[model samples]
Target: MGIVSNRQNASDYDDDMKRAKAAGIDAFALNIGTDAYTDTQLAYAYQSAADNDMKVFISFDFNWWSASQGSEVGAKVAKYANLPAQLMVDGKVFVSSFTGDGVDISAIRSAAGCNVFFAPNFHPGQGDFGDVEAALNWVAWSNDGNNKAPTLAKQLSVSSGDNTYKAALDGKPYIAPVSPWFSTHFGSEVSYSKNWVFPSDLLWYNRWREILQESPRFVEIITWNDYGESHYVGPLSSPHTDDGASKWVMDMPHNGWLDMAKPFIAAYKAGSKFPIEFLDEEKLVYWYRPTPKDVDCDATDTTMQGNPNNSSGNFFRGRPDGADTMADEVFLVTMLKEPATVEVQSGDISVTLEASPGVWSHSVPMGVGAQSFKVTRGGKTVDSLSGTSLRDITDTCPCGIYNFNAYVGTLPAEAAIDQLQPDGLTMLSQGLQVACPTNTLGASSASAT
Candidate 1:
């Protein structure tokens, strides 16, 4: 998991580490910038990781760094190279970066004066990897044909960037990135220009399946807490929202995606082809934009064109690219212990499918009104979500801006509940355990076990 440095205390880092560890994450890549508090935050993170029995490594953010400051970067990394929580690969310190493609690797290694395993996120064709032990592909989303300020257009395929990086490494270790969604909104108020939404329909499920198939040496979830981009999977914390991201992040909880990922993480570690066997309980995780696709936003917002650099003079105040392609649909994934009927109803439109004892995903056209979901077996309700607990789908945007962010929820809504303990791990409830019959059933079976 990628954790941006905004933590306030050791307890804050401890809380995040415990939750990540419970989710089957092996380590935390602390994303550090040149902020003055970075050193203090790193100290807290390292000590917290050790207390939680988790591993950590430093990931330098190049936005505030320059290639000429290789010595400074090396010195910062050397400071924590010997920490007990430091992640090591083959007895060497494991270090990474966000976008230091031009940084001198030899200079960093020489200054650190230790064996280093460098795996920076140098985009394809941008940096030399001769001295690198591994490479990390940072392009987690698919884009339109335009390279500069490309629109987040197609469903990401492994062959798009993963295959290219793997081929370039020529058998070196590759760390692949997996994320649920990506949406960023910023105007002239912020110095950097960013406003776009990637096509994320069922991306959480699709990407995990791709990871199990490709089986890279390692996988990094795009972020654990990056509210500004609206892809955070961690519970929203107020202290970390000083960057003006709370406008879009508050009240938008994504923990449901983490609940859906538990089984996938277990399957990946076990080298299983499918995550069905790893699923211990039945669950129905669903997500959708609170507003319909046709809603208009304030005219002052500039739509993201090709290249955020704005060198092509494509910048103008309007709707974002790929916004029109976003399907007005509700996406859901179901894990079942027996054959059951899954139904999704939005307003007057209802869609139903007979799902078997396995992991399955489907989407239905979204309707404006109260959203509801249910699972039935032998004419009896097994699990469901209804009433006012869920946010209603409205025709108007809540934020008054082009809010493309999603609000995720689960069917057995209580199944998503988690309580953190003093030990830093969550006390999970065994809510949806079901007993299956002896007879093995196929996907065609419509009867309950």
Candidate 2:
């Protein structure tokens, strides 16, 4: 669905209806900014939605152009806030600000309302949306800031927008907001918009495709009338201007923007079976937080000689003198994004140990010029080498005989890992190494070499 929450004028509804009906838009969201709207005005907006057969949504950017953190902040919000629990004549709930916690939605949803949508933090930075993971989760959380139900866009913004990633945004939602008219940087020949062009917007489309590949969220187009940010997809004309320099050129969007969206929407629906976005792939529509781990495993419980029964980690190449104990689950892949450290004690020997973070980081030393386990870190995880029958000159630490492990497959492009998964390792004491054959190995002459 495409959302245009900052709209004004009663006639604009007629115009929007006319345009949407002709455009084949499945639905459109409107932002009814405040309760100052009379019952008649509210009814007009809904009636227009019904007449056009367009699924309608309403919103209010309570903050408008005000700072969210000013001392007058709450007061300002109160001034423009909708009646604590008032419903529009259409009985639909609307948002004042698209940001997650701007209003208490859960409380209002209990009122007589039709539908409600949330517009989580938008247009942050030039490269992407800000607080990406938070934004992505909104689709699942219904844009609930405090875990409120009946959240915003319970699904996704198949056509919503995030102005421009002037920042780094996690592409959980494919939706983006566009207002070509407001942007002097795009769609205009004005000296102000020297770089914004049909091509500039392509950056977002391509980037979004990458994020979508990881999750199943959709996209959103921000405003249908916001022609100020210079990122608008609509006309950038000032109705009050008479001179040719300050007037809007009608039907400009019909000229090109829709054409750009058509093939894209079509291919997205087609599921990338025949899609192209420089380098496209199947996309994800949703995501859940990964399994959380207890980072503070044990500040003083790890053994000097780690467990030998561990298959996850089986390569030992440590003793760099200040070595500590082993960790649980953490590896090169995830350590970087969320690093961790722990300490273990072995009677009078307590050491704080830190893990190596990176793909194929901290190689393993099988023994005597030979290594047993290797990992690749990037994207997901993979083996440093996925091979079948191999011949080694030194049969050192055969199959499952090592005492160390690290993460793999958390690096980029030049993949050291191809197929194998995390070969986690644990430390084994010299005495214990001697006690366990599988945990220890001696160099042996190999004929396969």
Candidate 3:
């Protein structure tokens, strides 16, 4: 879902549409709240979608709007229902909401003056709603509940039960939701900010694999740009400067996550083995906290109000210490055309592995100085790049919250490759390599190019 709160221009929507469209997204489920500015920007978004031959629909934010009033939401939805870009499912206008259990959805259908295909995340602790055409679970944090849920088994059961139950009853389609990562340390003060990290360790790949197995009708990437919660898989240029949430991700390149998603989408649609199409080039997408969980970036805000694992509620029950789930290792998702030996070196430590083609990940522990990586084939280096320095305090702002941004760096395409030799090393084009520090760091050194 895309947030409409940012004061965007036609150019902004146009650019975002182009990016998402190229990535195999057909429509945008605009997650809008009750703000006058958002209402205005929504119009521009619809027009831009139409111009770009893309589809747009509403996923109302009842949390910010009047929850009890259905008429208000219907009226707002009706305004864009007739637009050329309005998303329609089997001739009915597609409609959804972030939270709308309190609102009368039947009344909303009547007020819209159109046949609405409504699927919403109306079920919290109250359980699933039978009235909607489909059900959505917006907050499936982790596959293994190691960090987010109580135990690994609970995580597996919860995911299995939620998907199985929703996809079975009524023969209705369950929207299979997949997110790359989750964190809200930037907004820990808010009620929803229980810093949850699903450990991107094979998260996107594994979740897509699960969703494909379930055979759900639709798939929704948790968010394109919910910058505060930090599951954003899109560019982070939009400002959530009000709470200084932008500082957490600022230039941290999460775009590679989106780029990596293209292959997954192709595989999901094809319903076959995911093809590693880009064999001509290689790229590595990696992320990690620069500092360990025990290391506090800010010493003053030690009240520990935002620790997700330590919170007293069911949503926040996991670890009593509320520590981070990630290990002190750089998680690597590499894109390769063929077999190659990849090396992650820092200080005196260097780990090498024989990597095959497709999306494979490996965790390399942090050492010292600036971390660097190299892709060697037949004993010759093909790709190499320097990453962020492993500093004690990587975060710029000494706030109590954690800095979860991953410092990413792509291997330069122009880098020279050694010539083929009889010894067996062959000349290969440089593949991309990206990595982040293990401690708190400001912004990102990652480049999309």
Candidate 4:
């Protein structure tokens, strides 16, 4: 499901539908607030989806809707209930809400002629909507790095609980969620930043595998365009751009995550192992936190206060998990069609692994030097990628704020080896460098065109 902006116009909807369809998605779950301006925008989106031969649904934001507006909400919903682009399931129009506990689902459905297929994410266990047709839980955070085994175990626990929730429906559907990463510092208005992360190192791969195993009727990628959350897998262009958030994200591209998701999407739908193909050339895509755990690179910048609404786990709970203290390491996913030795060079701590056909990932300790990678087979280099030069330690945040955005960079497939030149050095005597100096202010603040 695509998380779309209600500010989008007809043309923007057309373009986003085209992109989402190309990526094997079927619908855009328009995340809407209770505003007349948004109501008009939703109309344009519905018409655009109908024009593009796609489906659209509404995800009412409870944060924006009051409990007393039930009938009004229903009337507003019924306006688009019969639209051609409105997603229908088993003769009912599909509708879901974000934390819709206060808003009475049954009352809204009754007002809408009781013909809605309701499946709202009501946070968990606040109250049960036993009459709703389906169940949805958007709890897709594991917040761990590439330690695959433990990550899978944690996800399985979620899936296990979801399975029980599904069983309560007695054969109705469950919308499972999957995400690539989460870091909302640069774009949040809340008191504290959402610095938690689920490693993108094979994240798309692992999440899809787990989702397929759980066999949910529907799967929603956590976001297609919530750029502030830093989990967006769609383009960094306009209409689908920032919702009054940071400009830092406009330059930090996660489009590579979409490129990495194609195979997984196909496999999940077909219920078979879809051989991952190279959408682009064989490359190593990577990202990492610029500042590590509890490391203050900028003393002048006041660090954010704790989020009172933050979930109780790992980094959000003010307690570090086992992997929480793990240094900020470069996470790389290598796609190769043949066996090759992929080397991660950070300072003198160079580690090489024999990567066979398909995608495999590795993490190397980041240090006070440039980071780079090379793929070689039979003593000949096949392809190589040069990363951005690491920044120096500083005593101030570039934007004078606690910046939590990941510094994402890529060594393009066609990049010259000389482009990745790093200072020759030996093993890092310490672990991964926890914090790197922030880049110049506004360096990552380019607005989308």
Best by lDDT: 1
Q: Compute each candidate's TM-score over C-alphas.
A: 0.86, 0.34, 0.79, 0.75
Q: State the lDDT of candidate 3 residue by residue for 1-449, as single tens digits.
A: 22344445666588678989988888888888766677677888898899999999988887687767788888887888999999999799999888677778777888899988888876644534666777676755554434354354454533664655474445787776888766544223334434445555456656766765665678889888776566777665432223334334543556667766777677677775553752334676665554445554443332243443335332432221224555666667777777888787754568887888876777777554456677788887773422433233233332333555454434542132111121111101111011222212332452222
Worst 10 residues of 3 by lDDT: 423-432
lDDT of each: 0.72, 0.29, 0.60, 0.59
Residue lDDT tens for model 4, 203-308? 5557766876776888888887676667777655535322333433523456666656666677677776543553344666666654444554343232233234
User: Which ranges in model 4 have alpha carbons more than 4 Å from their true place?
Assistant: 1-8, 143-157, 160-164, 167-170, 186-203, 240-244, 247-250, 274-283, 302-327, 384-401, 409-449
Q: What's the distance in Å from true for residue 447, model 4?
A: 13
**Top candidate by TM-score:** 1
Would you list the rank order by lDDT, best first? 1, 3, 4, 2
Give the Å error, residue 42, model 4. Answer: 1.0
Report backbone clashes per prediction. Answer: 3, 76, 9, 1
Question: After superposition, which runs of candidate 2 have C-alpha atoms over 4 Å from their true positions?
Answer: 1-12, 21-24, 35-42, 64-96, 100-102, 110-201, 204-216, 235-254, 273-449
Tens-digit per-residue lDDT, 1-449, candidate 1: 12334456777777778889998998989887788778888898899999999999999888778877788888988999999999999899999999898898888998888999999998767777777899888777766534212344534454478987887788899999999888766545445556667777788889999999988888999878777677878876423523445434544678889888988999999999788888887888888887787887654233322334444333334455557657899888887778888778887788888887777888999899888887778888774432222567788655445667887787667434332122211111101012211111112332222
Q: Backbone clash tally for model 1?
A: 3
Clash list (residue pairs), candidate 3: 282-432, 289-438, 289-439, 290-438, 290-439, 291-438, 291-439, 291-440, 408-446
Stronger candidate by TM-score (2 vs 4): 4
Question: For candidate 3, what is the TM-score?
Answer: 0.79
Worst 10 residues of 4 by lDDT: 420-429
